[model samples]
Target chain A: GAGVSQSPSNKVTEKGKDVELRCDPISGHTALYWYRQRLGQGLEFLIYFQGNSAPDKSGLPSDRFSAERTGESVSTLTIQRTQQEDSAVYLCASSLVFGPPRETQYFGPGTRLLVL
Target chain B: AQSVAQPEDQVNVAEGNPLTVKCTYSVSGNPYLFWYVQYPNRGLQFLLKYITGDNLVKGSYGFEAEFNKSQTSFHLKKPSALVSDSALYFCAVRGFTDKLIFGTGTRLQVFP
Candidate 1:
């Protein structure tokens, strides 16, 4: 892929319902990241995956928010029992590599999730 | 913990005028600073970053940012503003991990 791509540009779910957001990183990029942005706010780090290493979940808002990445390929962010506060744009980004200081992160168009 | 601060909630500039967006950061060790731009209904786009070397870093859209270590600031600057440059700008600082602490976004409104 030329750039990071996310599926279902917009999602609407009822309160307490679950929703799944998908991300396909750029080809061969080993680093993937997820972020949440409220209406007009800055990004909030959700989670990140780097190669085969254990994901750094420190930023996940809560246990309800979990994500998985398969061998540096596609990744999915699942929100269990979604709340109204979960309504925000879910963004995905990928970098060619990590550990070289600030690796430029290419972002996806983002999936707008709205919990009604 | 690493954190970033964008003092201005909004910056208004006229076309053809130089524009500036202020940013400051706090971190334990060396900080990796970055600026990202977001257009209407779009995800953030990386504008530039400050890692090492020169204090000035140039990025896309003919914009550049100066890293002032003494001030712990990395302010975005453009000599000439364009109407198309109106957007939301964010300053972020990378921690020891991949986590990037972001500041409240600053909206840039360039008037033609």
Candidate 2:
């Protein structure tokens, strides 16, 4: 089966610019999530989207980070005024559903963002 | 807050030898534990998870983990190591929230 997919395998942008990373979840998946993985660090939760529900933006580090998912398919994570600290791998994952005894999350290759 | 901890930054083991990577978690209620691996320059790959039922959960690529409720641990283990298994392993835990809290990660290096 097709897995989650992300675009722009690698991105290089100047500081103060805005960058958008895209994610396409697996077919039939009803939940999507975005996370940030800094070099040699753990993954930091960014946002989550469930079918027709308000996205969870609790993990966004600041107002600069935001994400949106249309229906239950694709999601885009936008970072405004990118900073050096924003340089990291942006990963997307999706599952069949979100609930108790949560389903396994299938991940995408990720978009490596570099801010210069 | 829910959190996970991988005590070792790195673990080295010879091929054909058993290997273990430690993980401990802290959460408010019953925890949903997970294991994921990342190859160099690749995204995370789900290995296995411990939601309930059996204490020992088997996962992809001949890997398994033991969920110890009393200890609040879910350590990944493999009977024999393969060089191909070398990668960054992450332990994660989810409580009542929709997000998973991940550990710092453990790098596994298997020598031949």
Candidate 3:
């Protein structure tokens, strides 16, 4: 069985450029999550998709950040006009389900975005 | 609003010695605690989690965590440390479901 996978393992782009990071969740994983890990800091939640619905988008840092998932499948996070401050490792994770008792979230290798 | 704190920025231990990474959390209700380890150039790997029933929960690679409700702590422990275990460890708490609240992470360095 495959785990979560992300594309563009490393990306270096100029400030004000836009980048789209892709994430392929594990098969049958209904819950997908996106998190940003800045240098020497904890992971900051970005967005989450349960099936095709985004129940929580409050974690998006600003209007420039948006993510979409197509029903328990691939998800794309688009950072419109990226800034230097957006330099970080974007990680994707998926779980069988989330809430209640407890479920483990499997993480991906992550896409390291560097804004020049 | 829930929060988690890994008090120590780093923990150093000799191989074959016991190791402990401290994590404390604040949540409105019952807390679901979890441990994750991230090796260099790798994503986070699930270590273990504590939801209910057990105070001491054992996880992969002989790692275990003790959930102390009174102390509001869930510390990851290993009886014997290994150099290969040197990595970044994180503790997370899920209270509300928007997302899991993760700690700042603690770098564990196991020396041989």
Number of the top-ranking candidate, with DockQ as the measure: 2
What's the true lDDT of residue A70 in model 1? Answer: 91
- State the lDDT of candidate 2 residue by residue for A1-116, as single tens digits: 89999999999999999999999999999999999999999999999999998999998999998898989888999999999999999999999978865998889999999999
Q: After superposition, how far is residue B16 of candidate 1 from its true place, in Å?
A: 0.4
Candidate 1's C-alpha runs over 4 A off are none
Note the chain A TM-score of all models in turn. 0.97, 0.97, 0.95
For model 3, how big is the iRMS in angstroms?
1.3
Ranking by TM-score: 2, 3, 1
Q: Report every candidate's CA lDDT.
A: 0.92, 0.95, 0.93
Badly placed stretches (over 4 Å) of model 2 are: none
Q: What CAPRI class is candidate 3?
A: medium
Which candidate wins on lDDT?
2
The alpha-carbon deviation from the true structure for residue B29 of candidate 3, after best TM-score superposition, in angstroms, is: 0.8
What is candidate 2's TM-score against the reference? 0.98
Q: Write the per-residue lDDT of candidate 3 for residues A30-112, one digit (tens) a residue.
A: 89899999999999998888866645898999999998888779999999999999999999999997656557889999999
Candidate 1 lDDT over B2-108, as tens digits, reads 88999999999999999999999999888889999999888889999988899999999999999998999999999999999999999999868776788999999
Top TM-score: which candidate number?
2
- Give me the overall lDDT of model 2: 0.95
| Candidates' chain B TM-scores in the order shown | 0.98, 0.99, 0.98
